[model samples]
Target: MPLLKVVYLSNNTKLYLWKITEDFDMLFSQVKLKDSSLARLESMKSESHQKGFLAVRMLLQHNDYSDFDLFYDEFGKPHLKPQGCSIKDVEISISHSNDFSAIAISDSKVGLDFERLKEKTLRIAPRYMDVSHLKNLSEQEKIKKATVVWGIKESIFKIKNEEGISFLNHIFEEDFSFEDKKATAKLIFNNKEEKFQIQFDSVEDYIFVCAFEDVK
Candidate 1:
């Protein structure tokens, strides 16, 4: 599928999602990749991973950018090179899980995470999340909510991209109702506190979460 959905997460930020229904060859043929990206793609052992990588490029092309414009930092965070001396840099975040690939672009720093629905997320909820939040939900609801919480932590971690930021110990998600589709979290690490605004939703058995650094 081409560009499954576009989410306007905020006035300055937008999320683009791609459902990876195309075959590897089809996706590979569609996007023009930088030599480094081609080398990295050749290094990937799994077809699924390669496809996810290509689909991200496809999304970039959908938005008028290409792989040549994207790069990574020493911390492994993705960054966009300014198109020209006149164009300002935009914050970008990318994630892929199962059959979906997603990217978020914003004027401010942003983080995005995509997770497939699975029993493991619920089983391991106690390890990283407050299991108390799962108490009143059914088995399926537990899975969905736990997956969201996991994405919340992952999204925040992507934004901070700092060493020793343990999801269980440092990232704290506040109480939120499933119906709200939004929440808040705090990163209490290294004796510094930072706040983030969280937004999440489910898409075809997958969960998409986005975190934006709170402006005070």
Candidate 2:
């Protein structure tokens, strides 16, 4: 399916999502770039926006001819162009599967992540997830909830822009049920507890999880 239309996360936040098909080459050939300037992907750190840009423009065959370009601020954040896009202070994120590319833009400093569930991820769960977040997991069912638990914490850390937070030390989930199609995460960021709701959709090989800021 084509990427979902951008949604309103809040007055200042917009969300965009996409699902890529296995025929990626066919998909890439579809972007409507008659001619333009844009760097190749070998340089950028893995981001969904890059792939989604080509995929979305290919699907739209945009007439605006707005080329995609990204720059990084000193603190290390990607800046998007076309100034007329959406939110001005928008923080963006992208995630993709072997076949899918999803992107979301938000009003606050935000982070998002995507992971293909593999035995390795399962094996490393305890290393990245907080014990408190998994307290609700029954010993038997914990195995099944493994990915759900890991995704939430990883996403939180991504949003915080930090790596050594020790999921066991800081990641915590309040009242949430990943099985119910959504869950709530309450983790400490910058020593401040910022809580948010995470929604998920289960696909063939990977799970897509999103972390959002509270909007007034």
Maximum-lDDT candidate: 1
- All models: lDDT? 0.92, 0.58
* Over 4 Å off, model 1: 84-87
Candidate 2 ranges beyond 4 A from true positions: 1-17, 22-40, 43-70, 82-87, 130-144
For residues 162-208, could you state the per-residue lDDT of candidate 2 as single tens digits? Answer: 65576767777664555686777777756777776776655656666
Tens-place lDDT per residue, model 1, 1-216, is: 889999999898999999999999999989998799999999999999999999999999998899998989899999887765648787999999878899999989999999999999998887898889888889999999999999999999999999998888999999888789999999999899999999999898999999989998
Task: Write down the worst ten-residue block by lDDT for model 1.
Answer: 81-90
Clashes of 2: 4
